[model samples]
Every structure is written in C-alpha cells, then in structure tokens.
Target: MLTVDEHGLTVSAPWRSSERRIVGVIRDAEDWVLKKLDVWNAFPARKQTWTQDDRIRYLGRDLSLELTQDTIASLATLRDGDRLQISLADPTHTDSVKAAVVKWYRRHALANFIDRIGALAPRLEVPVPRLFLSSARTRWGSCNARREVRLNWRLIQAAQPTIDYVVVHELAHLLEMNHSRRFWKIVASVAPHYREACAELNRMGLYYMDI
Candidate 1:
C-alpha cells in the first residue's frame, strides 16, 4: 500500500522483494510519485490549532480543550461535557499541547482496556492473562498462545461498543488460537452483534489512526 499523509508518502513494499528491487521500482515511478506528492501537498488538512478553533473527537464525540494550571505537570483529563481539560507546566507551548493530548489518550486507553477486559473476561469464561497497549500500524488487537492480549491504544477514540467488540474478539483467541468457526462462536457468545461491529470496523479503515 502507498499512503500519503502529513508524514509524507509511505511505500509498503512486499517483504519478499529485495531492497534493490523496491528501489528500482521507485526509480521507475519517480515522476509519477512526485506528481502525486504535489497533489497531496495541495490537500488541506484539518486545523487542530490550540486556540479558539481547535477540536478533536473522543469516543465519537467532538470536544475542545481547556488549558488549566495544576500542581502536577503535563496532564490532560477528560472532564464533563465537551471539554478535555489539560494541566501542564507549559500549556502555552504548542508541543506541550500535543503531548498533553496524547497523554490523555494513553491514560484513557489504558483505563478503557482495563474496564472492558475486566467486564468481559468473566462473562466470556476466559482468563485475562495480561493486557498491553500497542501503536501497531496494521492490527487492532492480538492474542498470543500465552494469552497475553495487546490492544491498539488508538481504540480509545472509538465508541464503547466498538471497543467491546475488539475486546471480545481478542479474548476469544484465548479459547481458540486460530480463527476457526469455534473462535468466532466464542466472540459471538460475548458480543452478539459482532458481525455488525466487524463490518463497521472494516468500514472505518484507519479511523483510529487519528492523533
């Protein structure tokens, strides 16, 4: 896959292909790639300015940030209503704003993961071996043979139902290591509307990739 974003173009070359082979392909398509880059650079991105016009989404809800001072440094917490308030040592700094926002997401993502797993594991009759957060590019959740579950931290931006679906899906792997009929059956037992959730998840490709 070729993806162009704020980080510039990314080429996901085939693994089996040699570096030399990929470089040859890039050389052949250099002009086309440059043209695409010109077009991509012209595209407008959403302005997430920290002042009056900034807003972001959490759990499918739009919210603005409110900067505040606190005894502790560099913290952002989701408060009631449409404001995600942050308390940082230097709230005026643009870098601090971004860091605080990410901190908030990581904090809540962990909380959400713990909550969902705590609630669903017992109901699914599976032991919650361990939980970890991942910033993996291509996977939402995973379960190893050892039963440790790792969920994408970006999932905190998705709705609770969607998060539950992923939680149930990975937990099912503890019961069935492979994606056999029995594995999906276990997922369905916990999340009855898993098909819809799966379809919705597929439809929202890279939605959780937002910062």
Candidate 2:
C-alpha cells in the first residue's frame, strides 16, 4: 500500500516481509519515486501561469483555454465552445480568471455528480445520498456514515465513465463502509465494468490534472 503525505510515500509491506527486503525495494525504486514527486510539484507552478496555450480536460477531452477580453461592457465570465470569455475591469488579471474557471468547474461538477448518482442509486435500490462537491486535493470521493457522498470538483476534468466509477464506489459505501469484498461486490453489481474503470482512473492519476 502507498502511504503518502507532505514527505511523499512510505511503502507499506506485507506482514510476512522482512524489514531489510522492504528497505532494499524502496531504495531500488527511489529514482522513479522522485520523478513522480517532481511531476506533482511542477504542476501548481504551471497552473498559476495560465497562458492561452494552457489546457484543461472536460469529459476526458483536452481543450486549450483560450482567453478573450471584453471591454465593451461589464459582464460575467461565460463559456462558449471550449473556451472562456472573460469580461471585467482587467481581463488579464490572473486571480479573476482563475476564480471564473473555478466557478465553472464547481457548477459543472455538482450537476454531473448529481446526474450520475441519481441514475445509479435507483439501480442499487438505495435511497439517494446527499451529494456534496469538495475541493480536496488528493481524494476523489468519500462517503461518511451519514450517507452523505462528497465528490472532488476536480473530477470534472475526468471522463464520464471515471465519474460513474467514483459515484458508484461511494454509493456502495452506503451499504458497506470498509473496503471489503462485499463492498466491491456491491460496486460490481451497480457498475459491471467497474474494474476497468478503476484501472483507467488510476492510470489517469489525480495530480496530473489541475483543479
């Protein structure tokens, strides 16, 4: 298992494995681990410098963020086609642009999550859980004991299938909180191709997408 934090990862080994073997393994994989960490660290800097060439993914499609200025009259930022049209006192202001983009993501994330959960909950024969969109950096989704499901707004950048997996995964938790075999069985029942979807989500990697 991977235990990660500000210090990066700590490789947890099987109970039967020796400490020496685990240390040797970590040492051997050190270079690759460092490279992955570097990729995560570099993205925040890139996200801050939002040039027209910058990209954002929507429903798994990568689209360039083309910023347009509107000085004719004051208007709220709006999306037309795949780009954002910003109207404000300063169109080039980084903070204002970022805020508008974030607002757009939040609006879409809530709508998409609600749609997916509304569709799947009926299939499971469970009452629809209250949905909440989160800005969590690492977690994609979570379900509390209250049956409230929280999905990361950044997931709006992923594909529809990936979003379905996360929704179904959390819905299954309404039946089983722990990640047991029974919990996975519920997930499989609701989403038959969940295994493939989960693998795709892993390969996509969370940190690669800027929130």
Candidate 3:
C-alpha cells in the first residue's frame, strides 16, 4: 500500500487483500511520502527470536523488514559451515544498538546480488529482471513476465549459496517461464547442485522466521 502526502491520503496497492490489516498515516511535510504499510512495520515483530545485525527488522506482525545499515560483515555463528554474517549491523554486539541487522542486510543484499547478477547475466546469456529491494514479509523473490523482479530484502540473513540459488533460479526464468523440466535443466546447468542448495535454503528458514 502507498501513503501519499501530497494528496493527503493513503493509496492502497490493488494487489493487497482488503481484509489485511493495513494502515496509512499521512501527515503534512515538505515532500510527498508513499510508504508501504507492510514495509513500514517490519521491525520489533521478529526482533526477539533472531539475532541479526542492523541490517533488517520486521515491524508489526508480518510487516516488511527494515534495512538500517549498508556494509556487510561476517558473523561468528555458523549455520552448517556458512557464516551467519549480515552486511547491515551487529544487533547483539555494537555501539549502534538496535533491532536485528537483518533489515538493512535484506535491502542491501539484493542490491548487491543484483549487481553481481548483472556481471553474471551476460556470461550465461540469461535475461535479467529489473529487481527492486523491498521489505516483503512472505516472499524472498518474485518475477513477472514483464521482466520486473521484486525480491524481499530479508534474504541477507540467509546463507550465501541460498542467495545464489534464488538469483540463479530467477535468472533461469528468462529462458523457461515456469518450473518445467527445461527450467531445472537450465538451472542445473549453471548450478550443478541446485537441489541440495534448495534444501539448505529451506533448512535455513527456521533460523530466521518467528514462531
């Protein structure tokens, strides 16, 4: 949903369900503001369970995760040999104490990966979708036939291979529109062990989600 300040009202995203608890507060300001209801509340909700840096934080309930910092750093914890490092901030250990760093990492991670994909795109002759960072609560990545991609920024909390799998999977769509045999073939061609990588992503989900 979008909250417009210039018009002094809230504009909801047509795709959102009316039953969903979405609120918009528009106050007078110099510039126009259009904030998504979900994105605005992506903090505190998921703060208690996960230990993220200043990267991203889910606000109210299932809201969008906020990304507060930029630079990525390696964490000490290991989720199956992969270091749980967030490029956002050190939530548990830092002078800038705040909610989980997953928020910032979520936003920046996609931006970083998209750039990496740009380099990798030409190499594999794959079509790259125009991705924008968002604080979506449910999904990690989404694609449209129009070549537009919207990915959840919270993915920064995930493992590196998992991140690659998502990007590669999306890119593979440029060849195959759906999850068909040809799609798996293309994905496997580039990422030989994609099946294992996919399983790792699912396992990693437990560490990040709220109960």
Candidate 4:
C-alpha cells in the first residue's frame, strides 16, 4: 500500500517483497504519486505562533484567537461564535497559550466523537465501540480487533459531516475489517455522501498538519 501525508510518500509491502517489485509498482503509479506530492508542496507548512488575533480552525470555520492574562487559572473558551479566547497566567508565553488551546480541542473532540460513534454505531447494528483521542500525524482514525477506535484530535477542526463519515468508516470495521467492496457498501449505507466527505477530509489533513 502507498500512503501520502505531510512527510511525503510511504510504501508498505509484504516482508518478502523485492525492491524491484516495489520500484515497479511506484513506477506504474508515478503520475498519481507526483500529483499527491505536488498538492502537499503547494500548501505552506502551518506553524502556530500562539499570538493574539491568530486564526484557528474549528469546525470548518476560522476563529481568531483572543489572548488574556488571568492569575487565577489558565483556560480556553469560544466566544461570540468566532473567537477562541485563551486565558492564562502568562498570556505572552507561547507554550502556555498553545497548551491551553490544545487542551480545549481535546476535551471537545472526545465529547463530539463519542456522540458521533454512539449515534452511527446503531445504524450498522453494532454496539458503540470504545473511542480514544490520537495525535497521529498521518492517519485520521484507526480501529483494532478489540473493538476500540482511536481518532485524531485534529478532526475537531473539520465539519460535522466530515467527522460523521470518519465515525461511520471506523465503526464499519466492526463488520468488515478491510476496505473491500462490502466494507464500502456498509459505509455508504450510513453515509451516502461519504465520497465528498472523504475528499474534504483529505484537504483538511494538510491544512491541519502543523496545528
């Protein structure tokens, strides 16, 4: 299998697969590989400065960061529907500001993902699997044989439909473990527009890379 993320291309093959065979595969898919690499290269690397008025992405919208100092406690909150207000003992400290904002994202991500899983799992006639937050850079979500699902916390920055598609995709694994036709059929049953959602999520993947 070949995967592309912010880092570039990765090829996964059987242990005994020969280097020549791998090179042949990549050669056959050269155009596709190059296109994906070009897309990543087109987007400038994202680096959060944690400064006031900085733009933060949440739920497909850009919210400006509002910084303030509070000697009592450090906290982050959404205000006026378009601002993420982060209050800290030292608001000028970049690390503290970033930490507070990330904490808020994780907290909200857990609640949101749990709700999605709970609602979607039953549609597939499966019990809601255990959900956990992940910080992985290359993948959005994963499921294991133990019926546990781990989703990237950065998904909180995506729209609700996109999030639901991922939830259904992972929950479908309970019935079909691989990306076979049956598995995709199961996904489509619950999320008819999953193809569009998949494309949107891919775009967001690069956008959320550094954040």
State each candidate's clash count: 0, 0, 29, 0
Off by over 4 Å in 3: 1-100
- Candidate 1 differs from the real structure by a C-alpha RMSD in angstroms, to one decimal, of 7.1
Stretches off by above 4 angstroms in model 1 are 1-47, 50-53, 68-72
lDDT of 2 by residue, 1-211 (tens): 4433222465767779998898888888888887766654553333445545466667777666666677665343435656555455565787766776677778888999999999999988889999999876667888888889999887887778878988988898888875667887998887888867655555555443444
Give the number of the best model, judged by TM-score.
4
The per-model lDDT (C-alpha) reads 0.74, 0.72, 0.52, 0.85
* Higher-scoring candidate on lDDT, 3 or 4: 4
Reference-based TM-score, model 4: 0.87
lDDT of 1 at 186: 87
lDDT of 4 by residue, 1-211 (tens): 7766422577867779999999999999899999987776565667778999988888888999999989999988899989999888898999888888889989999999998998999999998898889999877888999999999999999888988988898899899976668988999999998988877766667777567
RMSD of each: 7.1, 5.3, 13.3, 2.9
- Return the top candidate by lDDT: 4
Model 2 TM-score is: 0.72
Q: State the TM-score for model 1.
A: 0.71
lDDT for model 4 comes to 0.85
